[model samples]
Target: MLVAPFPPSHPLAWLDSHAARRREVGLRRELRPRSAADPMLDLAGNDYLGLTGDPRVIAGGVDALQTWGAGSTGSRLVTGTTALHDELERELADFCGAESGLVFASGYAANLGVLTALSGPGTLIVSDAANHASLVDACRLSRARVEVVPHDDPAVVDAVLAARQEPRAIVVTESVNSVDGGLAPLRELHAVCRERGALLVVDEAHGLGVVGPGGRGLLAQVGLAGSDDVVVTVTLSKALGSQGGAVLGPAAVAAHLVDTARTFIFDTGLAPASVGTALAALRVLQAEPDRPSAVLRAAAELADAAGVPAPASAVVSVVLGDPARAVDAARACAERGIRVGCFRPPSVPEGTSRLRLTARATLTDADTALVRRVLAEVLVPVAAR
Candidate 1:
């Protein structure tokens, strides 16, 4: 078995061609450095409840750093899990009304962990066409027969699940679609899954700490939180104003994941700082239940100002049909001291570029006024251009 040596070429040359193609289509992206003291009004981040910089949350992180020495040191199955991790998992499960919970390094990993662990060659994964990329990637990695049905249509899901040849099935979706900020019909979806004997896995990344009673999540409000057939995954980074993610389900499911889920067993445990800050943030949410309402109100106000419908959650999307136009609109907002998120392909569908604004509970009246003015005087003209 003799192999001939090939002619030499620059190892990274292919990247230049790809970068040029992206630039031609207005899809190129670059990281913009942010300073700690930049005085721009922030509507670009996911801090829905505005607790990330809270003194209490900061103190929680500081204390954990002093105790845990900054890192988890190893994977959870090795030496990553700490007493803080255990406490956070227990409190998270209690808050969400689940029998048990397992923390992961990030929400993406949690999605991958659960989907890969639950489905395989003999499983059928019915995923929403508009599901987050994490779930989509997880399905591809699961070796399952995947069928993507129309967005928010439970009837289509039911039909697909009924026609699947696999013995075990699962339905994957998000409680709130990030781009359009529309709520999924979880009740209907749950009914279909239950009737078809399929497991329903809903990502509450945007729903937790922003929806439901006391911000427990949409499933809890619907009385489905601890249901045997329903599993929920949530991120602490959003309304919780921290980092890390968790999967909430039966104690049996958590135990199985500890033994089998690749992401959980192989990835480093979430840092003690993140766990502690998340715990403190959860307590803050519990104490100030009205914070969730404030976030909703802010979202509605922003949407109204932007001439869009009130969103289902704290995210409000303003669609600008062309990618270049959307980028210009975002830049105009930025020039006016407003920070907003610019979404283009493949983060969004082609020709549907948008400016994604997130509402915060801490937005003052002046901030709201500035956003309204930007939407009118800056964004409107740039989007038109």
Candidate 2:
């Protein structure tokens, strides 16, 4: 490989001096951890089921803590394998309609493991342009020939797969695009992949509780779950209101991942508390799937009442058209005791900035009304500016 060290002097040494320029442009981000006592109308998180604070969830974690102690101790292949891990994997696979499953410490790592393990040097990866950053980065790291098709355009994906020299290819997409909350045509895309003799991988990070029948996710809604060739990745951190993630697929594929996936083999297993919380939330979703629909309705109504209708999901994005204004709009909402997420360049693929809002099942009609008022006030300043 190589030896190319930077000389003692290079020409463009001024790049490091521009850190202040980013702050001046309002592009700088800072961390402020939300405490349980913060009296704010929360909408910036991914806890769509509102199960994060549920007594049952906390109780389950407490029980697991008593039983399994604190950490998983090591990677899944090593000393980390516990009864909790096995039980969570079994239940998640059953819920998602996959033959088997593997849990990861985090969803980001799960995506990395699945993509990198499945694709090799000669593989072709047809990915949606608007996929999550983790998936996009996975493609880059896979060293596979990547062809990013237009968002949700199965025809473009079909074309790319059709032209591939190596049809031993994989098609990667998010069932519900995270940025716009727009759903991809899963059945149609599945059929296209099948016709082209390609494997399909669906990221259900946003769809697990927000779409599909019984809140089983898009694969189940579209009747493609448990297929011989389909694979699914999901984050327990989202609607489940817990922590950790999973990769679901055929039994053979899951076994292969166990033997080869770097992320699964090298990373620590999920915490005992997170696994317990997720188990509780999954049971809750199984018991009351309609709660998600109610949240989706509230999200739709909240956006409509704001005079800025978003898509039909828990994720509601109010487009601000410019990055700077989007940040300012978010600030306005925060000042009013309403926390909202700001989407800007690099995070948003469309180059359009927005205020990203998530609707949780715990948000009542009264809560929706409050959010409506906040949106009206915050978005007004955006329009004037």
Candidate 3:
């Protein structure tokens, strides 16, 4: 039998009304079940390099699981740190040219951990207006005075930093923005941060394995990788096709995070399987330098077909104006054997709901042709409407 609903005066009653409002606005979200072998041409996911199904990556994960069991067993400070974890951290730090690296359970956790630990009452944080949601949430959680500058404009960033009276400050930016795949002015931002004696924290969640020579990342491209004041956070789940996140920085910062970062201190360590798979993926990336370039090529091709600017990274957005139109476009793609992402309000600004597609290195010419046809067919009707 169905239980009676909560009373009208109950605190949870507000959620029902809010949900109804969302439904009216076509902003309500639903979880669509996906099978393991969907066989659709997938452009909606973040597996840019397409290493998730690579045999070597799977082998690495299997080996680690056999050796370390499944879970990390405890938090890193307790029994969580395994030999594989140590090796992965060392390799990641070496690969990225950072003095030290620390792993977190998820990219969200890593962003939260670093931002909260680094910024305090005496510190000011200048964030880009179009930064990721994780960064936005992190800034809020930091309790620091955060000034959001115009997106990708380093001059405004400089002005804000110059006007700040805080004893210390940090500038946070994503190397490649998650929404439109536009590249940030990293060199200019770094210069501004350096001149202001502020730390530069870059989230390389999208750029780490899809930008720079051999995919070292945008910081490496701008010669800021090993800089003492530059800190980077990356997710193993995106380009690496693994799971977990890591903060790369100077040894002192890493040490401080270990002692002070609540996410690191309290959360369970990243699983051995993810750590090993990331290690394998990194090594594969080192060996197969063309994969990164292939990802770029695919994104460029997709953008050209869609009449959008070439993507700076693996993501490309096709604006569909409203949430309902965007959803229709995505569903149309699905019916045509393509899986495309639909971005509505909250994921994007109210007026810019779009079809967000990610380019994968593993996508074939046939896949490209199919995408071109499906997008042309679906987007035209949506655009006309």
Give each model's clash number.
0, 0, 0
Off by over 4 Å in 2: 1-16
Q: Please name the candidate that would achieve the greatest lDDT relative to the true structure.
A: 3
Model 3 off-target regions past 4 Å? 1-10
Each model's lDDT: 0.91, 0.86, 0.92
**C-alpha lDDT (0 to 100) for residue 16 of candidate 1:** 68
The alpha-carbon RMSD values of the candidates against the true structure, listed in the order shown, are: 4.2, 4.4, 1.8
Q: Give all TM-scores, in the order shown.
A: 0.97, 0.94, 0.97
- Across 85-142, the per-residue lDDT of candidate 3 in tens digits comes to 8898889888888999999999999999999999989999999999899999999999
Cα miss at 203, model 3 (Å)? 0.2
Q: After aligning candidate 2 to the native by TM-score, how far in Å is the CA of 280 from where it should be?
A: 0.9
Ranking by lDDT: 3, 1, 2
Which digits, one per residue and each the tens of the lDDT, describe model 2 over residues 156-256?
A: 98888888998489999999878778888988889999999999999999999878887888888878889988999999999989998899989888898
